[model samples]
Target: MAVPQFQHLAGRVWVCPGDPDPEAVQAGVAVVADERGSVLIDAGQSPTHAREIQAALTAAGLPQPRWLVYTHHHWDHVWGACAWPGVEIVGHETAVPLLRTEAARPWSHHYLDEQVRANPRLGPSFRARARAMDSWADFAVLPPTRTFADVDELPVGVGLRHVGGGHAPDSTIVLVPDSGVMLLGDCYYPPPAHLRRPDDGLDLVLVRRLLQDDYLWYVSSHAEPMTAEQARSAVETT
Candidate 1:
């Protein structure tokens, strides 16, 4: 339904669009940008979403992404990463082992067909977009050009830490300390706030141990932004 959309947060963090069910309120991409460039939390469902993310990066005075972090190995989150150039993909160590080298899996193969079978409630060009995700030309993802087993924190400019794992086994969260914000790739969505289906929440015990108080802004790849308190609270509920 109209390509996709992006939502801004505190004027720095942002979320882009994806192959979300048109009626769902929670679909799309979640992006984290700082002075260095932009780091998309999730690349989104299809390759077509690259333009939407590129526009956001441009508006923020950045170039094509220098880095990207996938929340997990799900096709919706990692498959479209090929759209951004010169990016050093980063994710958990196990991530690579889980994804397919080919996009011919039953789940992905059929899911695209589902879109085609359902036809244009998605406004104009929905079928064309669906075909793109199915075609290899649209995306050639690399789950994580760089990986971390336990933890790997890098300088994302503005004194921040891009943390990895602890969520679906490959989740990553980027934290900006001075601003008290943590750009969670996919580790922090509440049990059922997803723009798509139910993924429940993540490992509260391990996740709790991983978090530091310096984090204040907790932005999920699925839901809107949150606070440290909100992060703690949500974890407790889980």
Candidate 2:
């Protein structure tokens, strides 16, 4: 499949579509540009993916991001951060320790293959997704430089809120008031299959809370943007 290009969402927001292909998974990356500069929603899966996003932005004549925000500490959302050298990274307070833990992991190809050999249920899926990139030699997980508790408001009218959910305890949601859009970073998805645990109603609760907002569009990391009603229906049915 051809690499997806960043599509304009609304206002200053643009998104590069994510792929769910089992052989290689990728989370969508987005950017919100303002007079000050631009704030990137997620860094993507690898240096290659990050560069794809950069090329798309350059093709569209958009400015390089001034800040990079991780919606969570998930590998898919953060591994590409190293590509954006000087950009200040931000995440939820709970994500700090999680990222530190990730930074300590061995991301080499051999280590990943070993993990698959040790753990069957989860390892194969993980290894398959990691295959998205040709090399893991340059892979590094960079922790966020700035952390926030509940909400952090940026000068560009972008808001970051730490709303933990079933998918990840450090999950966060980004609100772009300028575009009336909310970026949902795998926050409503149920826990991984290996966890063997239910959301325990967290999905509905979070969806209800989110619907109270004035967002016109909700974009999940792995799926296309949705309407407020569509989000509500998705959560209720799931």
lDDT of each: 0.58, 0.83
Q: Please report how far candidate 2 places residue 100 from its true position, in Å.
A: 1.1
What does candidate 2's lDDT look like per residue over 1-238, in tens digits? 5665878899989888877664466788899977597999999888888888888888878889999999998878988898888899999988889889988987777777777778876674577556756777667789899889999988788899988987888898999987889998889777765674653444667777787567889988888789888877877787
Number of backbone collisions per candidate: 6, 0
Candidate 2 global TM-score: 0.92
Please write out the lDDT profile of model 1 over residues 70-163, one tens digit for every residue: 6666555665677777778777777787764534444344554676467634322334434545465545656577877765665665222334
Distance (Å) between predicted and true CA of 223, model 2? 0.9
Candidate 2, which ten residues in sequence have the lowest lDDT sum?
193-202
Q: Give the 10-residue window scoring lowest on summed lDDT in candidate 1.
A: 188-197
